[model samples]
Target: MSEQNKTWCPNIEFNETDEELILKAELPGVKIEDLIINAQTRFVSISGICNPDKSTDEKEVIPSQFNYGQIKCNTPLPVAIQPEKTRAEFIDGVLTISMPKLRVASAVNF
Candidate 1:
């Protein structure tokens, strides 16, 4: 397939703390403005576009293994989360998402 028609899925890592769940995705060559992130109580979806190298002419370019095209990833969260409180950050080609876990109140006996 052509570079622009290819689809790539970024590598993702998941971690959890006592109060929150963390998701990290490696998205090299993807710009912040091109990213789209959405989270629900049990799932998170990420999509973006990575533009192909434009500085070099097609005739002068060497065959490369780099991926450039549409990026997509849809993963289920390990635990229930507070979707309204989810936070995300992108830095150094990495995207980090912090989701606070849903807390259930225990029954109290009088």
Candidate 2:
């Protein structure tokens, strides 16, 4: 888990449906307000920082091992997507993004 802490959370999954691609990102302890979602073409990126712990605010003296800051990371998707049609939702610190795939015309030889 420490190695994962060095970067963003490692837990993620991708699912493809007839009309859309589903992406789920795990972000524990992160507030919904802090998250930012941006999508373009086939790539989507989300970055955000977890809110500071409430206990820290009451302390008169600072701790030596406490680490708090704006934690942000970006990840790329495997396929192209329509950014404007994309939708996102967050629940229990997990972010789920849905992107509709672009349509392509194919030719058939008779």
**Candidate 2, residue 9: how far the Cα is off, in Å:** 5.0
Candidate 1 off by > 4 Å: 58-62
Candidate with maximal lDDT: 1
Q: List model 2 lDDT by residue over 1-110, tens digit each.
A: 33224334326789999889898887776777877888888577776665455685586365424323445555676777888999999998678899999777799899
Off by over 4 Å in 2: 1-10, 57-68, 108-110
| Residue 52, candidate 2: alpha-carbon lDDT | 50
Each model's lDDT comes to 0.91, 0.71
For model 1, the run of ten residues with the poorest summed lDDT:
52-61
Model 1 over residues 1-110: C-alpha lDDT tens digits? 88878988899999999999999999988899999999999999999899876666566357667778898889999899999999999999999999999998999999
The predictions' CA RMSDs to the true structure, in order, are: 1.7, 5.1
The TM-score values for the models, in the order shown, are 0.89, 0.71
